[model samples]
Target: MSLAVALALGTALALPAVAFADADDSDNLMRKKRFGQNTGTVTTNSNTGGHSQESGSKATTETAVISDGAITPFITADGAAAMQAVADKYAAVVAQGGWPKVPSGKLKKGSTGKGPAALNKRLFMEGYLRAEATEGEYAQVFTSATEDALRRFQRNHGLSVTGVIDGPTLGALNVPADRRLATIKANIPRLAEYSKDIGNRYIVVNIPAQQIEAVNDGKVYSLHNAIVGRPSRPTPVVMTPLTVIRFNPYWNAPASIVEKDIVPRMTSSGASKVMRDMNMKIFNGVGGPEIDPDSVNWRRAVVDNYHFRQEPGGSNAMATAKIEFNSPFGIYLHDTPEPHLFHTGSRFYSSGCVRVDKVAILIDWILQGQDGINSSRIAELAETKERLDKPVTNSPQLRVAYLTSWPTRDGVAAFRSDVYQLDGTGFVVGQPLPVGETQGGKRYVLKPIPRSLEAVDADEAVGFASIFRRSSDRIDASERLPGASSKSTDSLVSLKDPKAKLKAQGRDTGKKKSKAASNGKTRAWTGNRERSASEVMSMPDADGTTAKKPGSKKVASKKAKSGDKSKTAKAKADEKAKTTKSTKVVKKDKTEVAAKKPDAKAVTDKKKALTDATKTASADSKSATQKSNTAKAAKPADCKAGADGKLPAGCKPAAAAKKPPAKPEKTAATPAKTASSTN
Candidate 1:
């Protein structure tokens, strides 16, 4: 035997025998194919009791099919092309820093060759093959060493114990090599979404794939396969902000779960000591709620109001550990004695909660891997040798999420069959960013938009109109003053009021006043504002520019004429007032009876004076009109009245008045005194 095979023998005891045997055959076959030889043969032969077998040394040689720098042996037209393509793809992968070609040398002990070296790296990455130590001199890959590692890798990646790098193994290692990395990146973001925000430490349950990761200090410290809720009772995705953890927790058997799964089984087995074995308390007949383990009928459970829960422990009938958080989602990561479930690939077979594989390891991680509770402590707990009460010093954060497609640190993206079919839109699987756009510290995301009222309500149109009217009322109130504090209050007051119209009118007037004051101008104060009504009215026409419609431009001629008519009317009003005063003085008795108070008498007297003033003003206006008419009649006389009040040069007399018109008093209401107090 060669020295290489001798070295291989030393390490054979530590590995499974099937691995090396499979590896030798695979390597030989691959090497022969690479060297452009016909390595395989096809034959059809049959020998039976009823049939005669032809025995001859007749050898049929296999043919080599060559194409695109590859040779396929003993393959037909279609099969040859496919086999060649696979070989070419593998060759390309080997060339890319991905895989390695075997070398001709003396095989060393515990050393993997190029192809196995790449395979080992991948295996270690997938968490199947681990490095026991770095002290050994045989720390590399050779034939025998490669076979051992491949054997372990195959076992961990859920493949059969055959250590050969078969087509399936090759496909997994080569295609989309970045899957693990993509999964990690994609899941990290999804985890962030799950946590609502990242927590200092959190527990994540990847339900579909049956894995749990306890993350602390932004690193994965403890990971285990978890048995989660089943399809019928799927573990809900929740973000529980953990605050406390109880040692020896009570397993509260949810009623729905108990009815569907546990009750029927318990009926078959009487008062099973399963809960008692876990150090739980049973409330079998407590509070008049009877759970006759062997006799209770499950068919009436749904309609029944009685509940059954495992009490907190001390040789109690409940689960041994409990974790408390603030989520309405009744899910907690807890330890289970049934550790065999972790050995399976699909762990979603629980009743709406997570059952962790290494519960002690997770607890230690929660305590930040504190001293005195090391591997020794964990081993003791597993062996049931340690009965001491181990309580957590501080609570750790726990985040629970439903990840259908989770990733590994090395970039292998794992996709679970959507057990719940929860990805309704199929969007939650691979999204890296939030669907919402961030703006002004607020994220506008794609929330499930609510259905319109019209779609839900029978009297939708009436409700819409009512809401619109109420909105209008609110707008009017807000535009003016303190708005209706509440819609209900305003509605109540409107309903209770005896005179809605008067109240509404008062509100309108207040709004108008508020609007006028709030308009572009500042409020007029006592010392700074002293313009009278008449003065303000006349101010707009003061400039030679005519006061046209706000947007128009009228000439000075129109303005001057309008001003002349107003001056003439004011002069006639003064003259009429003088005459009315003389007539009212003669009838003092009647005037006294009409108005007793000075303010009241002034208002009454003003009405009389106003009538006389209107008549005199009309007379003055007609005089001005007549004068204008006379000017037209005497155009040849050049009748320009100078300061002397006489016509310059020769002038003709104006035309006579046509008729006298009646006058009506236009009384203005006196301003009411307002008494308002501000504190």
Candidate 2:
């Protein structure tokens, strides 16, 4: 018995996961999700056996409890009708003043609030709770039932299903009822467009949700996660028929990619390197003449309208198969080598095509009715890397749409992030600048400081002239005015006048002193004034000019006797002579400065020219390179930090944000149709 049980368990582990279909259509709440829900166990298979089918609401089992994980195709007539009803209910809720804001804090199992008797009505009022909570007042107490309800709410909003309250949950729960109603109504038109001409068996690639749905007979047959085009290079919405399946396909570069991407890269990385890395060959036209990559100018190629064809292999962009369709947008479903991006919450990274995660399994499902094409044969062909094409005889009608809000079949509305800012909902996913462009910045050259000599020389000369003038005045007052009884000095005693000589003869000096004293008499003086040694030294020095002192005071008793001239007479002569010499020296400096003026001017002009050249070079570098400012503390509101305190991806500088969007990729002309269709 033990051996038998071990064998059965091993078989269960090895066997591929098969879809467990529900008996009743309404109990669609699934315990697992296969279409990239943030939570829940995802089971994927490459087998051709069956697919998972569960989509409707957050709760649906017999117990009518909220079941967290479920996969549902988003766009359909039934979903549209269901959402219209959802819109009405929301309008009524808005009219009645909407739901209460959930208390902001940690709320999980075992948490407590007011008792259950008063009716814990927080999430219930927001259409989250189907039945009454058994816990505290107004469902304020965190319990298992409350946790499940919270997870369902989070999942429906395209958020990670962490049972406790988070930044995103509070934001969604508190959205005004009127706004929510408006968002629903705004999305109704797109849903209505999807509803028309959609047959019972069809395929949907909802761009906002980033998930692909294969529906048959009004039910979800399988769901696969998908990566769609970015907002800048948005995937076009279209309705077409899945025509042919091309395996081991060659990827022809679109005109937009050639001009916007490959050409620009070739400018920096050389044409040969890019061609070798991408495994591409340049052709004169689609199937015209072959040209060597080294001989072709990549930029000129874009103008000449040359084509780029990537060979088929592991490095090929289309890994396994290509689902051909009829459209002008040049967008179709294909497989990718970088499958890890399928798990990303925002899978808006492609140029224009839809990249399916489990593409082989989907192909196997679509090719079932065709002869000689099966899972085993697909593996065989992929191993050999052989090119092949099979027509899809009963191919399902395909649609690519952008629906941010849709109601599941059971009336519980599910929402997706408005990645493209469609639905008129103000919310959008951002694309930040590359880290190398902002964080790991380029270095800029520093310009040198300028120094001019002309201004400095002129200022020094003027300063020296002023000093000499002040010194001369002080010396003159001390020598020439000391003998006067009032403020007046001798009429001929001018320090600035070269004509004033201090020589005085015997009788003339006496007559002059007596006459000047009599005429200048206003204030009274007692005795002959004398100069102290300290006063002589305290006067400001002229550096290169004369400093004169008063004559030694004569003895009062030994007044001027017979021909011995008074000592003051001799001192006056020396001062007048020195002042004249200093004035002459100043005039000589003025002449010398004037002679050097041209040289100083030339030095200043050269300095200015060097500075201007340096500034011009700095400006050129700024234009050529994308430099970063590491000192910025605040960010633009469009690229603000998130919960992790880091900038969201796709945030560029304000100058970069104004640039026009990426060019749309051109579609290849539809390949000629064929017969002998496959599954």
Candidate 3:
């Protein structure tokens, strides 16, 4: 048999098994019945000639199952073929060295340059431009044909079809062909995996591309720009069924927002202002009493005690509607108050919920066959601005996926920015993605992950308290304050001791004095007695003790003693000369003089008198030394001793030696008698 015939027979054989398998599960059968699956299943009966016969027939269908929970077969055979065709085309391009990169610059209609030439060549390679269009030199010009081709390429890639080659266009054009091929190869498994058991109608959200598409019978019914969560608060990947559509929905701000955004603003701007501005009402707790904003301490209530709910209005965070689905992450799709955010190429601004453009259209699409929910009814409800909850009889499956690269209808692989860095490819954190990409088109930079704003603000408010806390509180309990000299109980003991009080006061005074005295020059007293004596002598005594001038008397006595000695020596020399001149007469005179000279006893007594005078002088000097020793011993004990054991300044030394040794009176007669006896 032919290949086509064999495939047809295989499909025919597979249909009954799928129908039976679905029938085997009562839940699946009920779901299918609710979704109006296999509506062609019919039974017929006819009776003729008293005989009865029955005939039954059923219709078969194919579906795609992208994930475990997804029941819809959104990808049909044609869709799979189209995707595979694009992949195959890119694989061939990879083999042919891929499309050449356009020069890095902006190129639009009426601009002619090498950039336009390269762009045209690339578009031609990718099948946007026809072969015959690349013939002439004017082909390089940004002509209408080139503009049309560019627009077609942009439309296929989910970019703004401006026909202008902006930065994002250039970035897309510059991606290496090998990388494009790798993306196609990487996604082939996903395409195949999703090619089975999908529902008849479902929603597909491309997280990386920030776009959402509603598919029915393998064809796109609605397309919308999606504002997913920021990188720090990424939209979670999920596959589940959405069963309810809420009109003019009340938005209960998530705990994250209450703690991070609301509480801090409340603390800074006050509860009343924030509450009024946000159009929010505070509740005692979840489903509890309605509390006035002024009734509670916002700083404490925001942390764990209160819940915030914004009344339904145009200014509400959830603009006008919300689509609820079953997922562990509590994520859902809704409309946004800031509709302008949808105009940008990259829409990633929500905390974690997805904000869809023209969400009313999406809602209409989701509630097509459900009772009391149609395009006109939805429009009327939205105009009324009243809260309404509409239940969907047959819910549609939703699949949120991270697909940075995918095949476009024009047989080219379109690449988007890895906004969440989910692909494991290295990229700058905050750098905007290329134009025509998902995240960085209009200067949207990545921000840090949000923490509890109330926690941060509270900490700042208590910063001063933390600063002034005692050492034990700030550091450890065992650690005392620096230089805490006494225990708490010591205050009473210190009061009872006068000496202790004085010592404490002295310590305090000494500290102050040391600080004050450091600024002046200090003179330390050394123990040099000579310098001390000089200083003492220089000053006039108040008592008349130093008035007599002791040094003058000592000098005079010394002069008189030297004068007497000199006279005696001169007289002896004269007597000797006279004895030499007249020998006999001199001899008779010498004998008479010698006889007149004192006897030995008298000479010995004179010697004894001289020894006594010498002994008396020595005794006077010793007595003066004893007096100095006694004075030194009597010095105050508090006086600091110097290096030589002398007292410090403010103490006096012993009085000067009482008197110089008394000088013996001059003895002229005795010297003459001695000279005559020697002659």
Pick the lDDT winner. 3
Q: Candidate 3: which stretches are off by over 4 Å?
A: 1-85, 104-117, 130-145, 157-160, 192-196, 292-305, 424-679
Q: RMSD, model 2, all Cα superposed?
A: 45.2
For residues 1-679, write the lDDT of model 1, one tens digit per residue. 5322332233223222101000001111112111111112222221100001011121111111111211111111132233333334334444554433333333333445454455555554444445532114333553454566555433323343355666544544554434323333333334335544445566666665456655544444444556666654455554434544444443445443443344433433333443333232334432454444323332222312444444442322113344444433345666553444455545555555666654655555565555476545554443442234444556554545555443222222333445654443322321111212121222211121122222223222222334435433422111111221223232323634656644544454334444333332322111112322322222222123322232112334445555665565565555455544543232224533333223556566656665566666667767877987986786864576779888766665566977644332222211111000000
TM-score of each: 0.35, 0.53, 0.50
Q: Give one digit per residue, the lDDT tens place, for model 3 in 1-679.
A: 4222322232322211001110011111112111111112112111100010011021011111122222212234344466678777777877998888798777889988787888888988878888766668776788899998886666444455568987656766777877766665655544444433457788877676676767776655655657677764566555556767888877776665565456656655567777777677877767789876655544334344566777776366665788776544556787766655555655566666677777776777677747867767776776677788876777877776556655554456555566665453322122223222232112222332223544445333333333444545422211122322222222322656776675545554324344333312222121111122223343333232332323545545655655665565566667667655753334545634543444577667666665666566667767877997987798776676678999777776546776554333323334445444434
Off by over 4 Å in 2: 1-71, 114-120, 134-138, 425-679
Q: Write the per-residue lDDT of candidate 2 for residues 192-284, one digit (tens) a residue.
A: 766666887788887777777777666666667677776645665656668888887877765545544566555446677877877778887
How would you order the candidates by lDDT, starting with the best?
3, 2, 1
Query: What's every prediction's RMSD, in angstroms?
Result: 30.5, 45.2, 33.4
RMSD of 3: 33.4
Clash number by candidate, in order: 25, 17, 14
Q: What is the lDDT of residue 271 in candidate 2?
A: 71
Higher-ranked by lDDT: 2 or 3: 3
List per-prediction Cα lDDT, in the order shown.
Answer: 0.39, 0.53, 0.55
